[model samples]
Every structure is written in structure tokens, then in C-alpha cells.
Target: MKTGKKVVILLEAVLAVLVLAAVVLMLQGKNGQDMVKVSVIIQNSDDTQWAAFKYGLKMAAEDQGIEVYIANTGETLTVEEEKSLIEWEISNGADAVIVRPVPEEGAEEMLKKFEKRIPVMLVGSTASKDRSLSALPVTESDNYAMGTALAEELLKDYNNSVEGKTIGIVSETGELESVMNREKGFRDRLLNTGIQILWSVTNRSGEPKENLPADQPEVNFVAALDNNSLTAAGEEAAANNLHGAIVYGIGHSTEAVYYLDTGNVKCLVVPDEFNIGYQSLTEISESLRRFFHKVQDKAVSHTVLRRETLFTKENQEIIFTMSQ
Candidate 1:
């Protein structure tokens, strides 16, 4: 009788431990579920670049276990509006928030404030001061590199013909960092070639009389260098003396592509936005997983993504069919 009672007690203890273990596993599953929620905020979700990035994020999230949400401020958003959108995401329990900033100065401070509570990742560009606010950054391309590459491609085909030719850069605005960088690179490259940059004008702001003096050499090419500024510049170019100048539209904006096909613009430097998005997620997902598992100190942060593909008439068919 005593032996039988001892055996029964042992069996009960084993069953009790098993029940406790099962309960612990259930709680752990719930905790893991909470970690899966991720939100990405952008200036505009419909923009081609952001769309491509979202595609990558979607694909990556599908392969890995994640609940991904994308929020944007629509087609046109001010800095304050975008900031409010991000704050709302954070307040609603977003484990991670990724953003493509509208105004770096104001946005950075807002993002930094949220970072104390949750991980805030910045995708493109940077604030003037580089404090450690971003959990990760994946950028596509910048203006300076695109401008230099555009000039190089032009130079390659032109051989010796472009050496003395003058180029014009038509922009709509001058405040964006990407725009300024491209302009600087374009000027530096052209002037270095001993060629002339005949005129550079903004859309909202017209050309200065002294800058486009009558004695200056004619602009052989006018590079419509931005998506937002292209239409206005195209109109301005048509009205001005550069009606038939070769036009290079930078960035793969829908209007830019249309202009290229209509013969209003010559070519475009398309940034690989999909790749930037995919790589960003692929890299960050693993890092995030590792951080959660305690295998790493923190998520792998700060990746600069490339965003330039030279598009031309010869490659028109390929570019046209691309979804994102």
C-alpha cells in the first residue's frame, strides 16, 4: 500500500509540472504576438519610390512572421501633418516605426522623442545634426550622385562633342537637400570639364537677367532634375530660348517618364527603390529578431541604400513594365 501511494504521488507531481509548463508556453506565445506589430510611416505612400519600398516590405514581411502596417500622409503633406501621423502610430502601440521624413529638422525631434518609448527608423536623408535617433536608415539615391552619373553618361556618348557645350538645370525649388546636392554635383562636373553651365533656374523663381545674359553661349541641354519641379520647368523651358534643348529628367516620376516618351525630356536616372525597401527589411528583420532574442546588443542600424538607375530610350520597354 505504501509503495503504491508513493508511485501515485510521483505521477501527480509530473502532471502538475507539465500543466505549469504549458501555461508558461501560452503566455510566451502572446508576448511574441505583440512583438509582430510594425508600422511604417511615410510622407506619401503613393509615391513611386515609397510604393516600391512598400512592395519590398510586404514581401519581406510575408516570408518572415510579421504584422506590417504602412501609413502615409497622402500625395501632398506638410511637416506638421506628417509628424502628427507618426505620433499617432507610436501612441497606438507600434513596436517599430519607420519614416521617410518630410521636414528633417522638425521631424527628427519628434522621432527622437518617440524613440525613448519605441524604435524609430528613418529611411531616406538625414537631419543636419546626426545624433543617434534612427534605429535604421535605408535610402535609395541622392541628387549629387544622380547628377554626376547623368553627366558621365552624357559625356560617354558625346565623346568630345560635350566638352564645350553648355548645360542648364531646371528646378522648381532650391530648399531640399537632395536638390541642392544634385545641382552642386552637376555644376562641379560640368565646370570641371571646362564646359559651361549656361543657366540654372527654379520654377517658382524665374531666371535672373544677369545669369542668362545675351552674350552667354546657348544651353545645349536643359536637365529637368526633379519630379515636383519638372512640369513648371518644362513650361518655362518651352517659353524661353531653350525650347528644343536636350532634357534629362532625373528620378522615375510618372510625369518624368511621360515627358521622356513625348520627347519633352530625353532620359531619366531611375533609383532602385524596390531594392532599397527589400534590403532594409531583410536586414532589419534579422537584426530585430536577434535583439529580441538577446543574441545582439541592438538592431543593426544605419544602412545607406542606392537609388539610381540610368533609364533611356533603349531601355524604355523594361522600365515601363516595372510595377513598383
Candidate 2:
């Protein structure tokens, strides 16, 4: 009888231990059930311009043991489209979301609605038209400073004799806060240089080349503020369509680097997109691990590359992130 009683006691103890384990897992929540999942949304998610940025995201995701999904999106997205995409991400089991916001009307309301449901991290640029909207954390470069650097390089090339140099400006949608800041920075640097800005245009329809008409007026230089604009200007310059304007601009793609290598572009300012990816995910992962952790804004740095310095050991590291 005592032996039978002992067997019953052992069974009960094992059952109790299993029950406690279940309770602990339940208390741990979804995090205990599976790995943390994150989704990313950006404009033209497959574009070559995002090569380095995506590479950074991959490295960070591996390091943090987090699952990341880069949503396929078109070249442009309306605020409504962004809302839908973000909602899909949350509904499909995303513990966190990172997005390059669509700069448009009604963006603030949309972001607020979803931010309450999950942690929303902003990348590339802010979604608000106000430009001062900062309720969420952002990871990007000092666009204004990048612009200043580009102008400084231009000034250096001309031996500070750029007082009367006529210039044309080109960029992606002029509405983006990043793009606007860069233009502002570049213009501010030349505010006292007596340089003439002949024309400035944007590609609202995703076609950078449209800004460069065959009969475009001649300018001493062309300042492109994004990869698309820089590449378009470089191609046009190579074909003698930019009226022999020397190309100086900010870029982040293999094609842009190629242009600089072949002497089609004068100077290239490359923002630290890899760090932007790594740091954004790193912050997001940390927040997931700790409930009250606040991720601060990070303004990544940039590097100025000339053709002669493109193959240096340090620059090659940047290129590997961008191309490989």
C-alpha cells in the first residue's frame, strides 16, 4: 500500500512541475512563445539605392536574433497606402515596425493611430508635412550637413573662385524632409558665395531624367541631392545632355559610385546608411527586450569620396556594404 502511495505522489509532483512551467511561459507572453518579429517598410524596397541600408538591416537582425521583413512597395506611396501597409505589418504578427515614412498630408494622424498598437520606428525621413513632428524616434544622416559638405567640395574644386558659377539643382520629390534639408544646407553654404542658381527641379513621378530636358539651359555645375538625381545627372553628363555641367552630389548606390569612377561625377557624399540600419534595429531590439527603454534619435555621419579615393581600404568597406 505504501509503495502504491509513493507512485501516486511522484506522478502528482511531476504534474505540478509541468503546470508551473506552463504558467511561467504564459507570463512571459508572446516573447516566450516565439522569436521577436519586426517588419520594415520603405519606398521601393528592392531598389539598388537601398543596397547598403538593407545590408545593415541584415547584419543587425542576425546579431539581435530578430526576424525582419522588408515589405515590397512601389516607388511612391500615399499616406493612405502607408497606413494600409503598416496595418498589414501589425496584423501579420510584427512585434515592431520600421518605416521610411511617406511625406504627405494626414500622415501624423495615421502614425499616431498605429503607434499606439506597437512600437513604430521612423527611418529615412519623417512622415509629417510639418517637418517639426517628432513624437517618434528617427534614424538618418545630418542631411543639411551633407549638403554643406557637398557645397564645400564644390567650392574647393573651383579654388574658391565660384563666385559667379551658374548652377542647376535636381533632387527626388522635393517634399521629403531629408531632401529639403540637404538643399537648404547647400544653398546656405553658398548664400554669400555670389553663385547663381539657374534652376532647381524635382521628380515627383519617379523619373529623375525628366528633370533634365534635352534643351536644358547650360550651367557651370549640376547639384543632385539623391541617388536617382545623381545617377540621372551623371548619365546625362556622360552623353553630353547636361550642357557639360560638372556633377557634384549626394549618392548611395553602386551605379552612383560607377559614375564617380568614370569621371562623370566630380564629388560624391555618401551618408552612413549601414549604421543607420544597424543602429535603428539595435535600438528597436533593445526596446523589445526592455519595456521602458527609449530609443533616441541618431544622426549618422557621411563620407566624401573622390574618384582617386574610391578604392581606398576604408572606402572599400563602405562599398562592400553597398554592393555585396
Candidate 3:
């Protein structure tokens, strides 16, 4: 009788241990013991503009049981340089890669070739706006829609009576597809509105080549088309260098937010960069887990912010994500 009782106790303890182990395994998912490796490459990866995006990636990394590595990249990357970096990551045993593509000719083709070896995804701008964009998996907001929205906001401010308003357009560079598309959208919306575009300046990312005249001689407003340009515009406005022209543009960064908070920028259109980072990582992890699963293009949303609405519940959440 004593021997039989001892055997029964041992069996119960063994079953309990097995149950606990199963519970842990279930909670940990496929990465209970092994971690999937993913590498991210971005041009100027260290830029603060990527803060929200990086935050999202970090959250997804914890949830999806993957280890992520973002490569140290330069201010501008060439096609050959990007290709070499991808090759190196693969050789270093990266299970997948998330890349911010260099907007150059032949970049898409290069990425597609890497796709064959491992799962690949894109964040932010694609290589081109052609049919090739559909061929690659990407996460980003609709740049064209954002530009149109900015124009709408500006028009609303003027009550659609911009007939006497003269404006100058400032952009990081007139070359980037994003910048060009935004300019097109903004211009298309202003067609027949009688708003005079006095001048359009490109190559104003960092410190301007020349300071904007603070004297109101020709323009009534200055529109910045990208983050760097918007921030530059805001700085000029704060310092009274933009010639009292109202500042407006699309931006995503702490500095941009600071300017908006201080009432320098008239309005800001920000892409949901957090969602871009989170969704991209989640999709890549899903593909790694399920080989048959195919990731598709995800169009994230954007929000137009003004100083008064900057700290609302919803926008505050967005600000938090970007700041942290």
C-alpha cells in the first residue's frame, strides 16, 4: 500500500510540472527558446525624426519575440552602398530585414533580389512611385494625401479667399519623390485659387544657404514641404527671419512639435510613424513564423495639428510616442 501511494504522488508531481512548462511555452509563443533576428537599415538612422518609429519597433520586438538591429547609416546612401549593407546583414545571419530604401534608380530591383533569400520589408518612402511600389511590402502614410490635406488646412485658414495671398514654397530638396509629390499635391489644390506662388526654394534642409529676409517685401506666407525644411522654417519664424510670412508644412520630430507648441508653425501634418514601425515588425515576425504568410503594403494614417489642438488626448498620445 505504501509503495503504491508513493508512485501515485510522483505521477501527480510530474503532471503538474508538465502543465507549468506547457503554460510557459504557450505564453512565449514560437520564440520561447529561440529569437528571430531582424535588421533595420535607414539613411541617417540616428536622426531624431525616427524616434517614434524606433519606439514602435521596440514595442513590437518585445511582443513578437525577436531581436532587432538597426544599422548605422550615413546622411545619404548610394545604391551600391545600400546593396553592400544588405549583403553583409544576410551573411551575419539576419533572418529578415526592414529597410528605408534609398530613393534612387534600381533600388527596388536590388531589394527584390534580397527578398528571395529572406523576408524583406520597407518603411517610409519607397524606391519609386510607379507600379513597382505595389510589388514590395511597405509601411507608410499616403504622402500625396498629406500634401493635399496641408493645402486644405491652409485654404481653410484663409477662408478660401487666398486671392491676394502670395506665398513661397520651401523644400528640403526639390528632388525627393516625397517632396516632389507633396509640391504637386499642394499646387494642384491651389489651382485657380488665385494664390500667387512668388518663389519656390529647394535645398533648405539644414541651415539655409541664405537667411530669409524678415522684411515683408514680396511674400505673405512660406510653406515648408518636409520635416527638415519645416523645422528650418519654424526656426526662421521664431527668429523673425521668414519676413513675417506665416509658416506651414508637414513635419515629424520633437523639434517640429516644439515649434508648433510655441506657435511658430501655423500647422503640421504628421504621419503615424509609430504604427509604421509596429506594423512592419509585426508583419515580418508573422512571415517568419508562418512561411506561407505574405506581407502586404500597409498605408498608415496622418493627422493635421495646430497649436491649440496640440495637447488634446489623441494628439498627446501621438506626441508621447514621438517623444519617447
Q: Each candidate's lDDT (Cα)?
A: 0.57, 0.85, 0.83
Residue runs of model 3 more than 4 Å from their true location after superposition = 1-33, 131-134, 204-218
> What's the TM-score of each model vs. the native?
0.67, 0.89, 0.84
lDDT computed for candidate 3: 0.83
- Greater-TM-score candidate between 1 and 3: 3
lDDT string for model 3 (1-324, tens) is: 699999999999999999987765543334446677899998788889889999999999999878999999877787899999999998887888999877677888898888887888988776665635446788888877888999999999989999978988887666555677788889989999999988887664333365343433558888888887788789989998776789888988999999999989889999999999999999998887765688777789999999999878999999998888
RMSD of each: 8.0, 6.1, 8.3
Which ranges in model 1 have alpha carbons more than 4 Å from their true place?
A: 1-30, 129-136, 201-218, 230-242, 292-324
**Candidate with more favorable, higher lDDT: 1 or 3:** 3
- Most accurate candidate by lDDT: 2
Tens digits of per-residue lDDT for model 2 on 60-85?
A: 99999898999999888898898899
Model 2 deviation from the true structure expressed as Cα RMSD, one decimal place: 6.1
- The 10 consecutive residues of candidate 2 with the worst lDDT sum are 24-33
TM-score of the candidate numbered 1?
Answer: 0.67
